[model samples]
Target: MNRSTVDVTFVVGYLAVAIGLLVARSNPATTYEPSIYTGTPMITWVTFAVALAIAVGMALTCRGREQALGIGLGAITVTGIVSLPVIRNYRFAGMGDALTHLGWTRDIVAGELAPHELFYPAIHSIASVFHYAGGIPIERALLFSMVITFVPFLIFVPLVVRELTGPSMAIGAAAIVSWMVLPINNIATHMGVHTNSNALFLAPVVIFAVFAYLRRRATIERLPLGLSPFSLLVVLSGIGLLLIHPQQMVNIVVLLGAISSVQYIVRRRSDDHPILDHPTMYAHTIVLGVVFGLWALSNERFRDALLILVVGLLTEDVGSGAEVDQRGSSLTEIGGSLGELFVTMFLESAIISLIVGVFVLLVWLGRTRLAPEAKSLVNYLAISMVPLTGMFVVYFVGTPTMAFRQLGFIAVLLTILAGVAISRGVGTLSNYVSRPGGTAIAALGLSICLVLGLMTVFASPMIYDPGQHVTDQKFSGYESGFEHADEDLPHAGMGYDPYRYDHGLNGVEGDGTLSGATVDSGTVDSEAFEDGDYADAYNGIDYYFIMTQYDITRELGVYQELYYSEDTLEEFERSPEANKVISNDEFRMYVVSSTE
Candidate 1:
C-alpha cells in the first residue's frame, strides 16, 4: 500500500476503535468481581490491534486526506482506553482518588463547595462548569474534562515538534507518543479524570506556547492587541495549569527555566554552543514562578502540607512514609514484596524506557544532521536528564502522594526526545527499506511492541488485582454497608488497601485504614474466630466485614497482607461463637454471637 492507502486504513482503523468502544460497553448487570480483565471481549483488543497497525501507517505516510484525523490517533487511543471503564460501568474511572474528586466536583457544581478551599481545584471547577452549564452529569463531565484534556496535547505536541523538526513524520510521531502513555507513567498519574493528569495533558501545550511566544515576542508585541494566538494559549492553558495542579506547573516551570537558562549561557558562549540555541524566556519563567508562589502562599492546604512535609523532613525520619517496620510484616515478607514491586515497576516503566532509550540514542547519533531548533531540543533533553533524575529522587524520597507523579515529568522529557527520533527515523526509512508498505510493516512491528508494553500500564493487570473502577453497585454496597454498621464500635475488613475500600466508604474511613484493632498479621482473629485468650488482647474487634475484594485479594495473593478468603469466612461461620449481624449481596458483617 502507498501513502494514500495507508492513510485511508488509518481512518478505517480509528473508526473501528470508536465503534468498538460503543459496542463494548458493559451490560448493566455486569459483575466486576471475578475479573473485568477477562470480561472484556476479544473484539476490544482486536480494535486496539487495528489501531496500532494504522498508527504506524500514519507515522510513515506523507500528506494525506485524513491527516488531521489520523494525527490524533494516539490521543484518541489513549482517551478511548481511559474512557472504557467510565463508559462500560457508566460510572467513574479511577479507584479512590477519582471518587473523592467526583464528589468535590459535585459539591462545586451545587455551590456548596468553593474552589478556593481546595489545594488544586481547576479540574473540579472545570468539571462543575460542564456539569452545571452543559447539563452533563458530574461524573461524566469530570472524566470528559480529563480525557478531553488530550486535545491541547494533541494539538500542541506536534506543533512543538513542528517548531523543531518542521512537520512530516514528527506530527505522526507526536501522536504515536501519546499512545506510548509516557506521561501517564505510574499509578500516581492515573489514566482517568484527575488534577495532576490535567496538568500532564496540558504541560506540552503550556511549555510550547511559552516557547512560541518567545520566538515571536517582537512580532506578537506589534499585534494590535499585543496578544497573538499562541499568547492566548499561554494565558489560558497556563492559568488552567496553575489552577489545576501547581506542583506540575512548578515542574514545567523548572524545565522551561532550565532551557531558558541554558539558552542564556549558550548565547554568552555564542557559536561554541549552537546546539543550545533554543530561545530564552526569563520573564515567562519568572512570571509563572511568582504566580505559583502566590498561589502556594495563599492556599492554606498546600501551604500547610508543604510546611508539614518540610518540618517532618528536618525533624523526623527522612522518608517516614517508607517505613517497613510498621508494616507488621517480617523482613522476609517485606523483601519479597519489594522484589515483586521491582518486577511491576520493570514491566510498567522499563519496557517503554527501553524503546525510548533506543530512539534517544538514534537522536544523539543524528544530532548534527538535525535542524537548529531540533538540535536545541535534543541538547535540552540531553542536559536535562541529570537534573530530572535528581528531581525524581527528591520526590521519590519525599512525599507519599501515592501517585508517584514525579516520574511522569521525566517521561514527558523522554517522550519529546523519542518523538524527534521517530521523525528523523521515518524520513530516513527509504535508505534501508521501501517507502509506504515496507515502512508501514516496520512501523507496525515497532507499534506491536509498544501496544503490548503500554497495556501493562493502561489496563487493569490481568492477575494481581481486579478492576480499580468503583462501579455504582460497588459504591452502593459500600455506602449501604457502612451505613448499616455500628459506627460507635470498631470494625475490620479483609482488604484494607488504601484504594480498595476507601471509595466504597466514601472518605468515612480517612486514608482507608482499618478501624478495628492491632491485628496487622494479614489475618486477625475476630472475637469468635480466635480463642478467648488470643482474642482478649484486642477485644475491640467487634464486627468483621467480608467482601468480594477480600475474596479476590486472598485468591490472588495481591497484597503483602490482607489474607482472608472463603475458607476463613467458613471457619468464622462454623464457630458457635460467631454471630451473623448483617449480610448484603456484596458484603457480610459478623460479630461474636455469644457477646453483646
Candidate 2:
C-alpha cells in the first residue's frame, strides 16, 4: 500500500479505538468495575486486543522512515487517548492529589490568587487560562491540560533519539517503547500533580537544547534583529522549569550539573578542551537556581516545608514507618538483599528496558576509544543514573512507593538505550545472512519481543493494583455530601467560608476547619460539640459534613487515621444533642444544636 493510504488507515483506526473505549466504559458516576482488560465483558477485551494488533501490524509493516514515524506517533496518541476514558470517568474530578489539584484550578478560574498554600501554581494557572479562553468546563480544561503536558514527552522521545543516533527504525522503536513503558510516578495514566508531569514533559526538550549548545549548533549570540531564536527558547525553558515545579527544577539542575561535571572530568583526563566556554551556558543555570531559591525563601509556607523535609532527612525519619512495615521487613534489618532489590527495581523500571540498558552500558564501557559525541553521550547517561540510584536506596530506608517517581526518569533514559541496543543488535545479525529472508526473520523476532513488551507494560496496573482510581458510587457520595453542606451553609460575606471539612472542598473558601478533629465511622466526640467549642474551632460553623466509613475507607485509604470506627459513628448517631440534617448511604450531615 502507498504511504498516504497507510497513514490515513492508521489515523482512522486510532480514532475508532478512542471512540470505542469512551463508549464502552460507563460514566464515573455509575458503578465501579475492575479495569477493562482485567475484568469481565469479553467484547471489551476483544476490542482492545484488535486495536493493539492493528497498531503493531502497521508499525512492523511500515517500509519507509516517514511511515515508521507516523506509526510510532499514532500508537502513542492512541495509548494516551485510551487511558483518558478511565480518567474522565473518575468520580468527583479524580481522587487523591488530583482532587487537590482540581480544587486549586477551580479557585484560580474564579480569579482568586493564593487560594491554597500550594507550592506549584503554574499548572492551575494554565488550566484556568484554558477554561476562561476556550470556554470549556473545568473537567475538560484539566484533561486538556494533562494532554498538553503529556504530548511533549511523546514528541521529544523519538526526535531526541533520532537526533542522537541518526534516523532509523530505532527511533520508532524507542518512541513506542518509551510511551508504553509504565512511568514510576504513574503520572501518565493518573492525573495528579500536573507540575511534576509538566516538568517531565519539558525535560527532554531542555536536554536537547543543552546538547545542541554543546555541539555549537545553537548559541546565545545576538542577531541583527534580536537574540537568536534557539538561544531564546533555551532561556525560556529554563525559566519555565523554575515556575512549574520545584522538584522538577531540582531534577533538571541535578541532571545538567551531572552532565557538566562528567564532561569536565572526562576532558581533563583525556587532555581535551571544554565544549562551550562562553559564560551564557552557566548564566542560565545560575539564574534559574537563584530565582527558585529566592521565591522559596520569600514564601513562608514553602520555606517551612523545605525546612521540615530537611529536618526529616537529617534525622533519618523522613517518612512514616507504615510504608516500611507494609513491605514485610525493613531493608536495613535484612542487610539489603541485592537480588531482591534488583527484582524490585527491574519491575519498576520496565523490565525489558532495564535489562537492555545494563547490557548496552556494559558493552559501551568495554570498548576503548570512541567518537567525541558518542563518548559524551555515554558519560552523561552513566551520571544520570546516580540520582535514581540514590532514590532507590532511600526507598529501602522509607517511603518505598514514593521512590517510583525518581525511577520514572531512569525508565525514560533506559527505554531510549534499549532502542539503540535493539537496532544495533538486529543490524549485526542481518550482516551474517546472505539473503533477504534473514532480515525478515530478524524483523519478525524483534516484532514479537516488542509486542510482548507492550503487553507486559500495559498489564502492570492490573497486576500491581495501585488503587488510584475510585468507584463512581463512593466519589459521588463524597461529592454530594460536600455540595449539600455548601448549599445549606451561609455563603461567605466578605472572607473565607465558615463551613469546612478535613479535605479540600472544590468551591469552599479558606483552609479546611477539621484540623486535629478525629472521627470514627461517621462521628466525632460529643465533647467536641459542647460549650460552643466546636463553633469556635470551625470559625462559628454549626454543621459537620461527614462521609460514610465504607466510602472513607475505600476512597481515602491513605487518610485512614482521620476516619472514625463504626462503633464511634453509631455512638454519635444516638446522641440527643446532635441532630441529623442529611443522611445517605454514602454520607451524613449533622448539626450541633448546642454550638448553634
Candidate 3:
C-alpha cells in the first residue's frame, strides 16, 4: 500500500478499536461483575501497544516537520481515546471526589441544590446544563463533563509547547514529555476532582491569551474587535475558574500578575515604555478582578469561603477549624516534606525531558542578549514557581491533602518548562545534522516519547488496577441497601449519607434530609459517637445509611481508617435507638426508631 493508504488504514483501524473498546468497557451487562478489569486484560494492553506503535510510526514516516509535529499532537489525542476505556473499564462512577461531583450534578439536574457545604459549583452547573439542555441522562452527563474538563488539558499542553518553542519535531516530543512528567497527569482519567479538572481545561486558554497578548504587544498593534473574542474568553474562563476551583483561580491570577510584573520590570530596566502596548491585556486583568470580586461579594457563601481561605493563608493555619492532628512541623521538617515532593516529581517525569529542561535553563541563564519576551516568560515562570512552592510548604504545615491539590498547577508549570527545554535542545541538535540524519534523530526522539507517553497513560494509578472506589459488588450492595432503607423508613429525614451514597438514592426520597449533612467519617472527632452524641446529632433523622466494613475497608486509606474502626462500628451496633433496618455485605441501614 502507498504511504497515504497506510496512514488512512491506520487511522480507520485505530478509530474502530477505540469505538470497540468504549462499547466493550461501558457495556451495562457486565457492569455488575466483581472484577474491575471486566474486559480482557490482554486485549486492553494490546490495543494500547498498537496505538503507541501507530503514533511512533506516524512520527517517523512524516514527510515534513509539521507532519511530524502532528504525530506528537496525534499521540496526545490518541492516548486520551485509548486510555479512556481502560480507565473507565468496569468503573462507571469514580470514587470519592467523583462521587461527590456526581451527587452535585444530580442535585442541579433536579433543580434543587442540596443544603450541604457548597464547593466549586461551576462543574455541577456545567453538568446540569448538559443534562437539561442536551436531554442526556445523569450518567452520560457526568461522563461528558469528565471528558470536557480533561481532554482540553491534552490539547492545551501541546499548544502551549508549540507556541513557546517554535514548531519543530520537538514540539510533539515536548508534549509527550509534559504529559509523562506531570504528577497530577492522571487527573485526566481519575474523574473525581471535577472542579480542579474543570479549572485545568481553561488553564491553557489563559496561557494562549497571554501568548496572544505578548505577540500583539511585540508588533505594536492596536487592540481591535478581533482581540475582543480572546479577551472575552479569558474573562469568562477566569470567572468560571473562580467559581469552580479557588486554587486554580489563584493560580491564574498569580500567573497573569507575574507576567505583568515581569513585563514592567523588564520595561523599567530598559527605560522603554511603549504606549498602550497591551491595552487589551490590562483590560482583561481589570475585568477579571472586578467581576470576580462582584460575584464573590454577591454570594455570602462564596464571600465567606474567600475570607476563610485568605485568613487561613495569612494565619499560617489553612486548616484552622478542622479537627486534624497538627503538631506544627519545624522548618527543617517542612523542608523534608518539600524534598520528598521534588523527588516524586523527578522520579515520575521522563528522565530525558528533565535533562532537556536543565539544559534549556542552563543555556537561557548563560545567554546575555535574550529577547525581552523570552526574558519575561522565563521570569514569570520563575515567579509563578515560588508561590506554588510556598503554598505546598504552608499546606504541609497545615494540611497535607491541600498540598496535593496544589501539585496540579506546579506540575503544569514544570511540564511547560520541560517542553521548552526539549524543543530547544532538539532544535539545536538538528541544526548540525543532514536531512536524513535529522529525520532519524527526530524518529528516535518520537519513539522514546511514544514509549514514555504510553507508560504515563497505562501506568497511571487511575488506569492500572486502580483502588476500589467503585466496584459492581459495592455499588450493587449500596443500591440495594438504599432501596431497602427507603422502603423500611417512613420519613425523608435521613441522616448523613456517608461516602456519598445519595447517588444510588437519586429519585427516591423518604424524608427532607439533605445529603452529606453531618460528617460520619474522616479525621473528625469520633469520640462524640462513643460518648453518645451520635443520637443527639442525628435526632430528627429517621434512617441512617452506613457503608459496610467490606466497602469501607476497600475505600481510600483516610476514609477506610475513619469509618471502619472497630469502636465506631461497635457504637453503631450497640446504640439502642438505632435498629438495623437493612443489612448487606456492602452497606447497612439503621432506623432511628427513637426519633421516629
User: Which candidate leads the pack in TM-score?
Assistant: 1
lDDT of every predicted structure (CA atoms): 0.60, 0.52, 0.53
TM-score-superior candidate, 1 or 3? 1
For residues 1-596, write the lDDT of model 3, one tens digit per residue: 37677667567546645754655465433332223333334455556556555654454345354345445445544545434533454344455556667766766667567422344677677777887899976655666666666666666776765556554444555555544535454523233445675575557667766665554433343357555455666777777677777667777776776666655665667655432254435566666667666655677656665566566667654653443333123213323233443343334554654664565567557752334544455556767677668877775555555566676677667666665665455556667986556656755665565454444332222232233334555566656555554543432221223445554335212233444522222222244444555554443444454544333433322232332355665676787877776555545556555443
lDDT of 2 by residue, 513-569 (tens): 332111111333333433224333334554453444333443233222232334544
Q: Which candidate, 2 or 3, would have the higher lDDT against the true structure? A: 3
Q: Which stretches in model 2 have alpha-carbon errors above 4 Å? A: 1-12, 15-29, 32-48, 57-69, 76-83, 86-93, 114-118, 185-190, 219-228, 271-281, 316-322, 327-350, 368-372, 391-402, 428-511, 514-596
* Candidate 2 whole-model C-alpha lDDT, 0 to 1: 0.52
- lDDT string for model 1 (548-568, tens) is 443454344444333334455
Q: Give the TM-score of candidate 1.
A: 0.82
Count clashing residue pairs per candidate: 1, 5, 7
> In candidate 1, residue 198 scores what lDDT?
67
lDDT of 2 at 406: 54
